[model samples]
Target: MNAMTTLTYFFPRRVLRAVVVLLSCVCLAASAAESEAAEQPNIIFILADDLGYGDLSCYGQKNFKTPNLDRMAKEGMRFTQHYAGCTVCAPSRACLLSGQHTGHVHQRANGPIEFRPDPQDISIGRLLKNAGYHTAMIGKSGLACNSQNGNHPAEKGFDHFFGYISHGAAHRYYPQVLWRDGEKVQYPDNHGKEGKHYSTDMFVADAKEYIKEHKDGPFFLHLSLQAPHADLNVPAKWRDPFVGKFKEKPHTKDSHYRNETHPKATFAGMVTNLDDAVGQILDELKEQGIDENTIVMFASDNGPMSEGGWDRNFFNSGGPLKGGKRDMYEGGVRVPMIAWQPGKIAAGETSDHVSAFWDFVPTACEAAGIKPPADTDGLSYLPTLYGKGEQPEHDYLYWEFHERGGKQAVRQGDWKAVRLDFQTDPSRPLELYNLADDLAETKNVAAEHPEIVARMREIMRKAHVDTELFKIPAN
Candidate 1:
């Protein structure tokens, strides 16, 4: 007390006041930081494999209803003109995680052989991990690389990862093995056709558990579900309801996919099962009281596929668009996309904002209050989600496919152009369509619109950066 009294007498009143003000400011700054962290919403991105634009009830599925997904759209923002990164799985996911388009992204195709990307390429998982979010990737990851090469989801910045690492391995619903982090977790019970553990069910259960464990988190979860894709597999409970719902069509031709007595019904049931999985995750979030602090987004990696005994025409899976998975048409790339966040994103909003998978990284970064890498070919759609601020628009969108003899497509405004077999015939004439008038792409108006076609041709050429891995031959 004697020393404190002597020091206080030596110190001037203005100096003592300045010290108090500085200490108060420090406390206020710390409190603001804590508040900001609490406000950073947890992000959950649910990617469906081969689920089409019209597969969901809200999106015009007549055979089966996706009440959960429909409700998600009702409570959030539904994107009418959203597109996937590519027409296939591997490249589409590559574009998504890398924040690059198919033109610029690594792993441009689901090749005969698996391809691995450069380890230096940044991923959305790494971006969020750096932003202090607990990251996990569950279900099928078709990213073309594994932990051995330092490209598995865990090595790519996800703190945890579970499910199938290979795209081909993910085709089977009842798997004998699944990946957990860097190790393979064997499922003895899921042996052959006598397995009770469906991969979809397991993924949903694990996702719920992950949410529960990270209830207080600003976590980032990529729950990639393998459903309504192929093999015509679904639990009896889901399949039985739609057993006789449609006229029976037995699919026995495809040796690659399992023989299904009721292919249509099974396909419908698989979609409904996927819908139920989404509902379960939403319920878990609500139960954990984190619904308001979470942003849940659902989208398919690509459009519908006629593989695995699943019929695209029967489901009208591509909606009013033409073509399917392999084609560069609207049906192949255009997909269903929805975003939900209570108290933040206003309900009952449908955004016709033309967006794509590449935009996700920037959007997520903005949501987390982190600056995205400057070189990304994506724009944040956060402003559109919040229903405020001036939303930026893209000049055009481009996609190139290596399979199906190589293809390229470009969409600028309402004008869409498709160039087939571009690798072998670089001088192939671009088939142009006015999407606003011909959404089905039945009419090729390229001859009538030579100027627009010429512009699209140039854009396509400029957009494609020649790569040894996925090459587009010169004219």
Candidate 2:
């Protein structure tokens, strides 16, 4: 007090009073900044594997109902023009987490062989984790290069990882073994027609536990669910709801994966089961009293698969869009996306926002008040999510698929250009469609609009940067 009074006496009375006020304001600002930092929300991104664009009732499915997903749409924002990273699994997930599109992303296909992400890769997990969010990746990690050598999810910036590292291994719904942070967990019961443990069930259980434990603060959970993909295997209890709902037909084909006795029932059952999983996660958040503060997003890795004895036509899985998986068409790349955040995102809203998986990394970073990597191609839709600030729109979105005779597609405004059979000849002309006029992509009006088509062709060539690993061959 003696020293403070002596120093205060040196200053004039008016100046002394102003200095005291300034000191108080500085203390208050520091406290406010701390409070804001502590309030960063938990972000949960639940990605479904091969669940079609029309799988959910809210997204125009007629045969089956995904009530939980529909409820998510009601509680959140449903994106109509949202697209997956790519047309298939590995590349799509790669494009997603890396915040890079197929053209610039490391992995570009489900592939000639299984691919894994690099340890140094700039992914959503890495970005959010650096921003102080406890990151965990649960369920199918289709981006792994192989079982062992490739960078594990932990190395790729996730604190914890549980599920199959290989996309190929994930095809077996009843996998004999699943990975938990590089350790293999055996499920001996997962051997025969009736496996003791279903992968989805285990995944959901772990997800609930993780949420309950981390309910306090910031966390990034990537729940990449491997449901409704193939094998068409759902527990009898879940399968019972959809039995006899559609025509009974045994799917016995010598395919890559196991065939189902009742493909349609099991297919619908799988989707409904996935819906239940989503509901469970939502319930857990509410129970933890973190519902409003948590940002829960749901989307599929890609569109519906026609393999594994699963019939896309029976389900009309693609909805009104053309083509299914393995193509660059809307059905293959476009997917259903729902973002739910109570007291944050507007309720009962539908956004025709043209967004993709690449946008997720930047979005999460921005929401957490962290700067995204400069090299990323993603644009944060945080403005759109919160309905505040300015939302930056993309001039174009690009994708290239290696399999199914090699395909490439680009979207600029309303014009969508797709070039197929390009592996043999990269110079092939693109099939053009104005998505604004023809959402089905049935009519190719390239002749009428040669200028747009030429621009698109240039974009297709310029957007892609050639890499030895993911090469677009020049014939």
Candidate 3:
């Protein structure tokens, strides 16, 4: 009944209750963090619009500057001979997200597409989402040109979405509005085409905000840049920095004339702007203290459209590869690729192994420690990136693009074959090149190696079966 007796009697039971609650909370917190980390590695797949193999300083372009991209090359693995699925944007992006080569994923060509990503077809976000990683696609979606369709990023299995639904919409950059999580999120800059505003800045700002907010867990950030593409204008401040350094009318490696009004200079400026954007995002990763755990990959969706690709004439965006976009040549599909993940991939290492855009889905899944959805076509390049694996992870990397220039290529080991197939007929004169000996693809060895051509055709048959081309409307 005294004060000391009452206090002593009540204190022990309450102390015991407090100890149990604290221990339980600690266990729950630890469990949540472990579950988060186990979902996979954080991935940032940065796709540059219409970028070329030689645009980056590290790849081969000399006139223009790209300190950030070059710096990434220094810290990560660089693929000397990388490729896109198609010569154009939409198909290339489709193959990339689907993990199927053009032949195995997208059945048709150049877009402004008529159809959306097939619901049946697996997407990178969908595959990763199934395995528990938080997936998103920001910036240019490249899924559809129209706003009303189901081609928005959210429809493709992305948990969070921003940027434009189509590449055409992003041409405005500082457009009137941007879509966030499948709806329009209005912004102040409503410059309605009388004068286009700077968009690369807007894209990077949103991307940085996303990274800042998502640092506590793993994320798949596809910050697909719309810069250096078309309408070729940017913040004049960035352009003025290199007005005199490059010539515009492009100069192609061939007798074909390069488009210059001093186009290369504008292209270079665009490249520089993209580099600055990359710097912003990478800086954020470092600031957030998640740089080491992040797997960041930088690659072009396809080759240059102009003579210099991103730049204009003075610079060669495709380096020593063959033709530019819309062609079946190496320059059309081949691109520069850099994969950076600190404390994982070997620094400054270069690989001649053939890599196409489809590899991204599987590689990201692998880095995140997540398994892709069932029946996925991607094979992870994780071991190769780390320098612990063998050469040629893929038996054959195939493509099918039917636009102004309809073509397809298959690379099996050192042997490569390309076809000039019409919309209905894929069986035609196949161009075979031993890429090991000829990087530019100047000579046709199909006549010399009939056996190799046959093998490539056999590969195409399987690709056709897997792609199910018959389902596509034949119009």
lDDT (tens digit, per residue) of candidate 3 on 1-475: 9865686687886786787799999999999869767646788889998788788888877776799988998988888878887888877887788777766564345545533554666677876776667887878885554446534566677898877876666666557777778677776656633245456776788888888898876788888987677655566677687777644444334332222344545666778999989888888999999888888888888888863333333466678888887877788888888888888888888987767877777777767666754555667777788777654377777776656435667888888788774445644577899888998888899999998888887776666543444232121
Candidate 2 structure quality by residue, lDDT tens digits, 1-475: 6866887778777897899899999999999877876789999999999988988999999888899999999999999999999988888988788888989887886643433444456677877888778999998884563556333777778888888887777777788978887788888878734588888888999999999898887899999888888777889988887888778778786556776778888888899899999999999999999999999999998888998778788879999999888879999999999999999999999999899999998998888998888878889998998999888999999999887678989999999999988877776777999999899999999999999988988888888889877777653
Q: Which clashing pairs does model 2 show?
A: 115-144, 115-145, 116-144, 116-145
Please list the residue runs of candidate 3 whose C-alpha ends up more than 4 Å from where it truly belongs after superposition: 1-39, 112-119, 145-147, 186-189, 192-197, 247-262, 307-314, 388-392, 424-427, 466-475
lDDT of candidate 3 vs native? 0.73
Alpha carbon deviation, residue 305, candidate 3 (Å): 0.4
- The top-ranked prediction according to TM-score is 1
Q: List per-prediction Cα lDDT, in the order shown.
A: 0.87, 0.85, 0.73
CA shift of 56, model 3, Å: 0.9
TM-score of each: 0.93, 0.91, 0.84
Report the candidate with higher lDDT, 1 versus 3.
1
What lDDT does candidate 1 reach at residue 154?
68
Q: Per-residue lDDT for 259-320 in model 1, tens only?
A: 78888888888998999999999999999999999999999999899976777999799998
